[model samples]
Target chain A: MNSASEAQYREQPAKRLRNAAIRRTGSSAFMTLLGKECLELLRSFKLVWVPIVFVVLGIMQPLLSYFMPVLIEKAGNMPEGTVIEMPPPVGSQVLADTLSQFGLMGLLILALAFMGIVSGERNSGASALVLVKPVSHTSYLLSKWVSMMILTWGSLLLGYAAAWYYTWLLIDFVDVGPFMLSYVLFGLWFTFVLTATLLFSTFLRSAAGAAFSSLGVAVLLSMLAGLMPKYMGWSPGALSGLAYQAVTSEVLLPLNSVSWWSIATAVIGIAVLLMGSVVLLKRAPAHD
Target chain B: MTELLQVKGLTKSFGSVHAVKSIDFSIQEGRCVALLGPNGAGKTTTIRMLTGLLAPTSGEVRFHSLARGEDHRSLIGYLPQTPAFHNGMSGMEYVVYSGRLCGLSASDARKRAMELLERVGLASAAKRRVGGYSGGMKQRLGLAQALVHHPKLLVMDEPVSALDPLGRREVLRLLQELKSETTVLFSTHVLHDAEELCDDVVIIRDGEVALQGSLAAIRNEHRRPVIELKLEDAPHAINWAQSFLQKSRTDELRYSWLSEAELQGNRLYMTASHMDVARQGLMEELTEHKVPFSRLEVGYSSLEDLFMKVVSG
Candidate 1:
């Protein structure tokens, strides 16, 4: 044990030690940090709760759509021989509605789950403890971002896949290609917003502040895109609409310039937000 | 001993308020140094800058063994004042996590974590979640994690300030053992802790270095002869004491010999530049005035006195 301690500190050459320290900014340290984050998720049961919530949300849309007519007749006081005419529910359309549900509830869960990802650790002095080592700010922030993305993408897949299965069983059949395309576009939109959450978490000291600010930003952008679709279609806020279109449209793909631009900008925006988080954390890892 | 680290003109400002002001100090290899200061003296800020947890607004922290622009974090381990852990994780897991973050391999990190936990007397509690650990236990766990990589310099900010007396003693004893094996720089408001464990002391006040040197050298340089006079609690004794205070102010020679004097109740405490002169002068004055005295004790001013004066000012 003594030899191990001595060798760890003394045996290594200076140049190699410096290189090892620098190398911590790379993938190896990122993996270690990522593993820790995953462990935290598992221990905290977020891995289970978040996905479960999404699955329930995904299952609700198709079930509610299938039973709406019967429910209306059962609940409403209608006169005898009165016919309540309603259009047939499309499977893809139901799935698109599920995406919209995710845009609200799924987005809310993710924002809250990840709001304290950086700030809590920082305010609690846990980040200060980890950051004093050879680990880099890039590795720290990237690990958090990657873990958040994994949880988000994984939950969305489970939920949307559940919705797709239910829609197929009850409503008209949807195309597999468009279903998967919509999921990716929607995932990109979620990523864009959650990246904003991570950025704000690093910049702000309060977790709630981070959550609300990012959610507000998402709301503002979506409102702008909703209000002026033609002028603001290239914004990341348009990705959710593009996701819905990818599902209901017969084209089986979103090949339009608007969708492409939204996807491109969302990816770029996520990257910039992640980079901004890295810079903020690098500036001050510990908050007083 | 060779220099391990040098901090040159390091300054940190939070808007208009300067937290640490152009502080300069250096640590020699294998020496245990204490950054001694009262609350709000910027000891924590200086330590954070050294550990790379907080970027300095100006100047630089240069490691002797590191090339310019090379990372110095690998050479040092840091423990913050109130070390918070991922409460969901066990003590063992946190240490291993810390070791791995410092670039240790899986096996090495595990082994080092085990050894350090044992060394810090937290081996039995290693499997328990950090949330369950007591303040002292958490501190020991913090120490284990900081030392897992066998860092050349271990910098801790107020390592024992939050602990009770028993906990403080336990940590101070552990630090005593660890100091011989590694270079340690820990900050503390408690002078006794600094005096008991540190080879060198850097006393800071109001974001500035008030005094700093080897403990023995500082003692020798700043030591002053102090005389304490305890008189019987009688009106005549108090009257004589009051008269002595007025005479000392008026008498230039007595004022030069007696640097400072204060009377609290029936006891008079005097700090003097020269022991013999003050002792002789007091004796003659007492005999001539026929002052009623109970006891007279002579000693030198302690570091505690210096600390109080420096910190209060």
Candidate 2:
């Protein structure tokens, strides 16, 4: 037993020494930025909490809609001879409600999540530390953007899954096929919107400025889609509303384009935002 | 030794104000140069430009690495005046993360982090969050992060300003330990700090170098032996002594009144070049004038005195 314990101790020291050496040699500029970003997220777990709460709210939306008729019956609000026609809460209706609420709210939360990425670092004097490292501005901004995207997508997935299971449990029917496709489309749209918001965050040097600028950009895109005929081919606002329309099969006015156009626009918008973020990060003063 | 860092006519401007104006200085291998300046004298700006955090408006900084041959970023480690770290990470984790950022692999980063934490006297608190560490502990951790990569040049901006006396001593001692392996360029407004730990000193004033030399050489060049005399009642005795010294064929003596007061007795102090000149001059004048005095002493000028003279002048 003594010999076995001695052997274990000897093996432990060598393994520990090897791990230590590996830790020291493994650090690269990109890895450091990524680690720093992850640490920042962990510090502000509330950033994670806000989206979780919203996702929980998304999960509850379908259940609330399905039980509304029962609730009204319990409340005895029905008048005599009144015909209260209620749509079935199963199939696409459940999917539509969950998609609309989760997608819109998720996009807003995702935008706000990144609003502090660059500006907060600058304000806290962390930018000086980061810039002094071997990392470039592009890698710093890209790491933050990627982290936000991952968190946002992860939260969205959780909300989608929760809502799907809950709705099935409530209505005794589940359509997994359309639900999965809808989730993918919604995730793509979210990625596009988040990338655009991050671009604004990187461009503006203050948290409030980034948040307001992103909101303004979103509003302006919506307005252009409403007012301009030639802008319909590439308006990003259509992508935000498309998740709901796809789930519900709701048809709006003719725009003379297929669904692929919206997808392409989202892809182009994401590329532009990412490129613009990189440029803004490169040009931004290091110390300020 | 080859030049590790060379700055040629380096200049930086913020709007209309020139923070660093055509300052030229260089650090050879294994030399510690202390940059001394008053507040707002552009010491921080100069360090920032040297570290490549800020681009110079006009001029160049060429850093030659012994190991990697001429890549500035690979060879320099910079500790900013107020170092900040991510709040969630422990001290060890933060240092390791910084190591990784400097191109270390994960295991190597951790190993270096542990070794450096122990060297900085922060081994016990390695697992504690950096945000929980005291100001001095954080500064030491910052130093550890900067040194973990083993860069050839370490640039620190006022690293000891926030530390307590003990902390200051610890950090200064750690810097002394690192002197043989790394070229350290630290900026400070504290002259004694520079005097204690620096091999060479650069005094910057009005965005330019006022003086730069080895500490001993600067002290030797500026050193002047003098005697200070405090009188009991003779305000006019000082003036009388100055004139008497001038006529006695002694070295030309200059006198300035440090203070005039009547606390506990009439106290007046004057400075002169030599002890004998001061003593004889005072005796002759006081004996002739029948004046009485209490105190007289002699001392050499300190680095603080020299610093004040250069900065104020």
- For residues A1-288, what per-residue lDDT tens digits would candidate 1 score against the true structure? 998988867856865875665665455678889999999999999999999999999999999999999988998688877798899898889999999999999999999999999999999989988888888888888899989999999999999999999998998778899999999999999999999999999999999999999999999988999999999999999989888989998868747888788889988999899888898888888886
Q: How close is candidate 1 to the true structure, as a TM-score?
A: 0.94
Query: Candidate 2 at residue B67, lDDT?
Result: 28
> Model 2: which docking level applies?
acceptable
* Worst-scoring 10-residue span by lDDT in model 2 chain B: B255-264
State model 2's lDDT.
Answer: 0.74
Question: Clashes in candidate 1: how many?
Answer: 0
Question: Per-residue lDDT for B262 in model 2?
Answer: 21
What does the interface RMSD come to for each candidate?
1.3, 2.4
In the range A182-219, model 2's lDDT, one tens digit per residue, is 67667877777667677766666677677767767766
Model 1 stretches astray by more than 4 angstroms: A1-21, B232-243
lDDT, candidate 1, B159-190, per-residue tens: 99999999999999999999999999999999
